[model samples]
Target: MENLERMEGQCLCGKVTVTAGRRDAVEACHCGMCRQWGGGPYLAVHCDSDVQFVGLENITVYNSSDWAERGFCSECGTHLFYKLKGAEEYAIPAGLFQSGSDFSMTSQIFIDRKPGYYSFANITPEMTEGEVFARYTP
Candidate 1:
C-alpha cells in the first residue's frame, strides 16, 4: 500500500512545481534514451494515480522519440518526467524531488541495453528489450 504523504518538488528555477503522493517503488532506468535525456542514470519514481502539478505553464513537453515524450522546465531546462506513448501514465524523475523520502530503488529497467561503461552486481527485477516492448505495446 502507498502511504498518503504529499511529495513536493520544483525545477532548478522554481518555475515548475509538482505535488504527488507517496509512490510504490522508485527504480533506475539504463536505456539509451534515458541517458541522453538525463545525462546520467535515470531514477524514476512510479505513482499509480496520485500526481498533481503546479506552475504547469512553465513546463515544456518534447517528444524525444516516437515512443516517449519528455517533460521539462522550459525556462530552466530541468528534466521532469517521461511519458510513454500509449501508456496510461508518466514516469516522474526521482531527482527533481526535495529528497527527504526513504524510497530506494527496488529494481532496474532496460538492464540488458544499459551502457557498457557501467554495471550492477546486485540482482533485482530487470527487463530486456523484448520484454519492455511487449509490455508497453498497445
Candidate 2:
C-alpha cells in the first residue's frame, strides 16, 4: 500500500511546481534514452496517478516514444517528469523534491542497458528492457 502523504517540489528556476503522493522508493532507469536524456541513470520517483503540477506555462512536453512523453521546465530546462501517453504513470526526478523524505533505492530498470563504466553499490532488484516494456506497455 502507498502512503497518502503529499510531497511538494519545484524546478530550479521556481517556474514549475510538482506535487505527488508518497512513493514507496526511488528507482533508477539506465536505458539508452534515459541516459541520453539525463547524462546518467535517471533517478525517478514513481507516482502512478497522484501527481499535480503548477506553472503549466513553464513546462514543455516532448513525446519521446509512441507511448510515453517527457516533460521539462522550459524556463530552466529542468527535467520534470516522464509520463505514459494515455495513463497517469509519472516518473519524476527524485532530486526535484525537497530533502526530508525517507527515500531508498529499491530497484533499477533497463539493467542490460546500463553501461559497465559505473555501477551502484546497492543490491537492488533489476529488470531488463524487455521486462520493463512488457510491464509498462499500454
Candidate 1 off by > 4 Å = 86-88
lDDT of 2 at 75: 91
Candidate 1, 1-138: lDDT as tens digits: 777877878889987888787765778888888888777778888755557768889988998888889889999998878887776576888877766367767898888878888776657798887888888777
Question: After TM-score superposition, what is the CA distance of residue 94 in candidate 2 from its true location, in Å?
Answer: 0.3
What's the lDDT for candidate 1?
0.79
Q: Note the Cα lDDT for every prediction shown.
A: 0.79, 0.91
Consecutive 10-residue window with the lowest summed lDDT within model 1: 96-105
Best by lDDT: 2
Return the top candidate by TM-score.
2
- Give the Cα error of residue 83 in candidate 2, in Å: 0.5
Error of 1 at 59 (Å): 0.7
